[model samples]
Target: MKVPKRVYEGLEAVRSSGRTNMLIVSDVLRCARSMGYPETAQWIEDNRNPYWEGIFQGFSPSD
Candidate 1:
């Protein structure tokens, strides 16, 4: 997917933090499996943020 510059930068930061990208990816996929992130993505996307946090934000999508 074509993501924002800040998102790419954040992913770099996360990777540099000693956490494998797979770890984060797994978390997001796990959450996505239980409940899709379309709602959160839409909510956050609707209100654009200068900084884009990664997929997992501690709160999974309920619906």
Candidate 2:
């Protein structure tokens, strides 16, 4: 799926911060909703990719 630039950037920021935990996702969700991007937040919430999980788990050093 093609994600909006803002959503992509937000997730990228999260990933870049090396924080892939649920809490960080939660923050993104909140921001997305407030920013009128609920779908973006929902998409992030729905995604359960191992890559993302790995990032969340601190498996990727540069994530």
Candidate 3:
């Protein structure tokens, strides 16, 4: 899926920082929401593994 430049860059940064999978997902969702990419945010939410609840824990995107 294609994401906004900032969201892509943010994910890259999160990866480069050696964040865990959950942290990476959280950051990407946060970026997508802050940038008005609700579809992207929802896609991430929908596509994520059900077992990884921590990935989206406490995150409620306004999108």
Which candidate has the top score in lDDT?
Answer: 2
Residue pairs clashing, model 2: none
lDDT of 3 by residue, 1-63 (tens): 344454444444444455345346676677656656666567567757631452344322222
Residues 6-62, candidate 2: write the lDDT tens digits. 656555555455544545657757766765666657766676574366444543222
Q: What are the models' TM-scores?
A: 0.32, 0.45, 0.41
What lDDT does each candidate get? 0.38, 0.56, 0.51
How far in Å is the alpha carbon of 63 misplaced in model 3? 23
Order by lDDT, highest first: 2, 3, 1
Tens digit of per-residue lDDT, candidate 1, span 11-55: 444444553543455443344333433443333344343223433
Off by over 4 Å in 2: 1-23, 50-63
* Candidate 2 lDDT (Cα, 0 to 1): 0.56
Which consecutive 10 residues in model 3 have the weakest lDDT in total?
A: 54-63
Backbone Cα, N, C clashes tallied per candidate: 0, 0, 0
Taking all chains together, the TM-score of candidate 2 against the true structure is: 0.45
* Cα error, candidate 3, residue 14 (Å): 11
